[model samples]
Target: MYPTLRVRVSRIEQLAAGIKSFTLQPCDGGALPAFDSGSHIVVHMDQGRMRNAYSLTSALDDRSRYQISVRLEEASRGGSRFMHEQLRENDELDIGAPANLFGLGDGAGKHVLVAGGIGITPFMTHIQALARQQASFELHYCFRNRDSAAYLDELPSTLAPDQLHLYESDTGGKLDIDALVASQPAGAHIYVCGPQALNDAVVAAARAAGWAAGRVHFEQFRNEVDATGGAFEVALRKSGVTLQVGADEPLLRAIEKAGVKIDCMCREGICGTCETAIIEGEADHRDQYLSDAEKAAQKTMMVCVSRCKGKRLVLDL
Candidate 1:
């Protein structure tokens, strides 16, 4: 794990009805760390060790401050609630160094950005970079309505009128993923950060239209939970312990509950810190960090999200 940096909140501004942008500066009064176009900082929330990842929205070259936006989500895992209600402008917090898994590719000449709701935060940096390089790019933002759109007030001033497109579902405006994918130039690359449904739709459409997998980029944030999680038996070969993991419990939690501690950073499986060798059984890989070749090999699995393809599985743990 990288060393944590202590930062102080410099300012807070409400961007929308329930969305607010926070500006953070180094508490020690030093320059903040440099970041890439689409980097994210992990915020350690409250005292519960709840780590929440927020994309950096401020300019990449600027070290004066780092900005991150948060939407109040009462139904969420309390991270958003802490940011909206408990966090104050002068509050000090510990944050992780910049990490990028969804950064822009320099080789891609034309860029197409598709954002849903708060997903536009990461693309703010990308937009500035594209403008500086005088590259061809377009942004399509999909929101529930005007009130739910967080960055509308600033986007118009920052982006050209022809480059930005807003689609409001409440007003019968449609994003039309199929049509959007069909309309893109053959070599143009697409960057997506949004809800699972929106991401899945874009990926599916791109693949169906014969777009290469390398040309499609996405930011993976949360743990994947479909209806497929079922009770499975895990065999810890090194410890000679067998544990039953329930549908509601993550594999890491089950292992920890059995008095086994595995070194992990991001439990969402995007960090690849909890990856373990698969002694036996087919792994139902669900992590965004692993490549298709690695998943097909079935030599390792991220214990945090992956499950056993069959009833029982053995781990080197």
Candidate 2:
């Protein structure tokens, strides 16, 4: 577990009608840990009542300050609204060290980036890195409208206008995943981060285009669930105890209810803090943090939101 650092908002800019860019600086002028383009920080808010994850929108090389864009989610569970409406300059907030599961590799022949709505946060860092290296890359950004698009003005001037393609869904023409995937050159690497619908479309199209799994990388904003989802019994291997998880209750909650303390940063499964080893039985991996191979091996599981596929799972607490 990483120690929480104190951060204060130094600057705030209204990027769009409901979106704002918050520039944060450490309370003490110490250099923060170096982070990659796709890394994110987990903000500890309201005395740990909420832990929200925000991607690093600033360049990795520039460590003096960090930036994150917050969009007002009316139906939000409360984090985004707090940041967007309640936060003010000089207000202190607790932030975790950077954690990343999405990053670019140097060996990729070419890069194709796809961003939807606020998903552009991480890609901003990717573009900065690629630009510094003068790598061949293209970005396809899809949004509902220009007014709702965060950092719209800064993107065109940052990258070649021709390499940046903007698609406004309200205009009637959707982002043709088939055309986008087909347009990529041979041996190109595809990176996508977006909502569930956009991600599904892109992955489906990429697979249909004969792109190998190794050549495609993606980060999902939400956890994917299995169709036959139901609660099961979980046995703590170390303690030799069992708990019956309720239908709507997550495994993490069930474990906590049984008096086992586990450290968890993001309950939504984006952060790997709650990961614990699974000694036996099949796990229905629902998290976006781990890779397919990691889940297949059943070495570790995010008990916060993930459940078991078998009738009973043995967990290494």
Candidate 3:
């Protein structure tokens, strides 16, 4: 597991209709850990019942505090609801150190960013870093309307008029993924963080246009993992214990219930912190962190979201 930081919520502001930004300062009034442009921290809440990743939206050089914006999810599993309703200023919380699953590429002549709804969080810091470096970039932001767009007022003042583009779907504004991909200059890299449908569309368009896989990057804002599966037995080789995982329970929860301590972040499967070695039995791999070839090998599984495909499975533990 990543090392955690004891932080205090110094301030909170409503950024949009359902979005709120939190300013977290070190509990001891010291500097927080430094993070890159596209890094996120896992917030451990509800005595560890919920662990959700929130991107750092503050400037890269600002160590005094970290900012994260959360949207009240309609179908939340208690994470967003707690942040919105229960959490208050001056409250203390534990959060994992910065982890970068989505990073700005090494070298690109130009960069294009596509964001949808709350997916714009990572780009908030990315824009700051890019501007300081005088890098070439363009932002294409899509949202339902102006009122729902988080940071709508700040974005225009932050970026050049020609660099930022907004698409309001409620007013007949639509982003043409294929056209956007086709319009980018050579050696340009595109980064997208948004809904599954938007992600799929951008990836498909890039592939159809013969763009290299390395040039396109994306991070999902939703938990698409269907944790529900048939009941199975997991045997821990080292502990000499076995636990019955319910059809609706995740494997990581079962391990914790059995008093086994495991390191995990981003329970949604985007982070690979919970990956465990497999001694036997195939797994129904559902995580996006592992590649297709890795899933075929069945050597390891992300216990947070992935489950056993067979009746009984053995883990190295």
lDDT of 1 by residue, 1-317 (tens): 34689999989989998989999999988999899888888887785345677889998889989999988764665678788888998999989888787778767868999999888889999998889999999999999999978888889998999899999999998898999889888689999988878998999999999999999998755722331388899999999999998876667768877888786656677778889999989988988779999999999999977888888999998
Q: Which residue pairs clash within candidate 3?
A: none
Instruction: Return the top candidate by lDDT.
Output: 3
Off by over 4 Å in 1: 223-266, 271-273, 280-299, 305-317
**Which candidate, 1 or 3, would have the higher TM-score against the true structure?**
3
Best by TM-score: 3
Residue range 1-317, candidate 2, lDDT tens digits: 34788888999899998889998889999887789888888776776545677888987877788888877776676678788778889888889888786789658889999999888888999998888888999999999988899878888899898779899888874678898889888889888888978888888899999989888888776422321258688889888789887666668767766778788755667668889998888888888779999998988988877888878899997
Report the candidate with higher lDDT, 1 versus 2: 1
Error of 3 at 161 (Å): 0.7
Mind giving the per-residue lDDT tens digits that candidate 3 earns over 168-240? 9999999999999999999999999998889889889998999899999998875435665999999999988
Q: Estimate TM-scores for all models.
A: 0.81, 0.81, 0.91
Candidate 1 local Cα displacement, residue 194, angstroms: 0.6
Which of candidates 1 and 3 reaches a greater lDDT? 3
